[model samples]
Target: MSPVRRGEKLPIYNRIGVLRAERKMTRAELAETVGINVQSVGALERGDNYPSLDLAFRICAVFDLPVEAVFSRTEFGAMSAELYRRPDLRPEPQSDPGGAR
Candidate 1:
């Protein structure tokens, strides 16, 4: 990846809001845990601010997840869709041929 020049801001997508909701954690809680202000958490969630490498690692640590899981350069899809995806490779279940109860 090329270095970002001065005054160049790249949009970073994140799943902090979803993760927080899943864990029942508030913005204030996450902020306190990560040593930042609650507003900063909101900004990060809204994609209005980019987190430093240290901040990203700290945030990931709070959820016990890797940085990639929390933050991504590309937008993420629906959590439910990702979690409950049915693979086409799996074969359908076979039923018994004999009439047995």
Candidate 2:
């Protein structure tokens, strides 16, 4: 697989690395579980290649996570940032104290 060009948008982004780290799973271990080469796992994690639908399903099964949680077309921002984001707590713009034209 070709390396993704810098600044090029990938068709899909994955949480494989995060998931592996969370589960303390090595690439070889995950590869064995998914019946793929270890290098393929690394490539998938690095966004060098997109997974086939079958492979995607296999990966999700290995992680026990929904496809949406494992992969997304849009970039998934940092989990901590997303979890801590406070939209409602954002300060509203101060209204004009006096009604000026």
Q: Which candidate's lDDT is highest?
A: 1
lDDT, candidate 1, 1-101, per-residue tens: 66998888778999999999999999999999999999999999999999999999999999999998999989999978988998888778889899669
**Clash list (residue pairs), candidate 2:** none
lDDT per residue for candidate 2 within 23-93, as digits (tens), equals 99999999999999999999999999999999999999998989998999999989788768877876889
CA lDDT of every candidate: 0.94, 0.92
Candidate 1 lDDT: 0.94
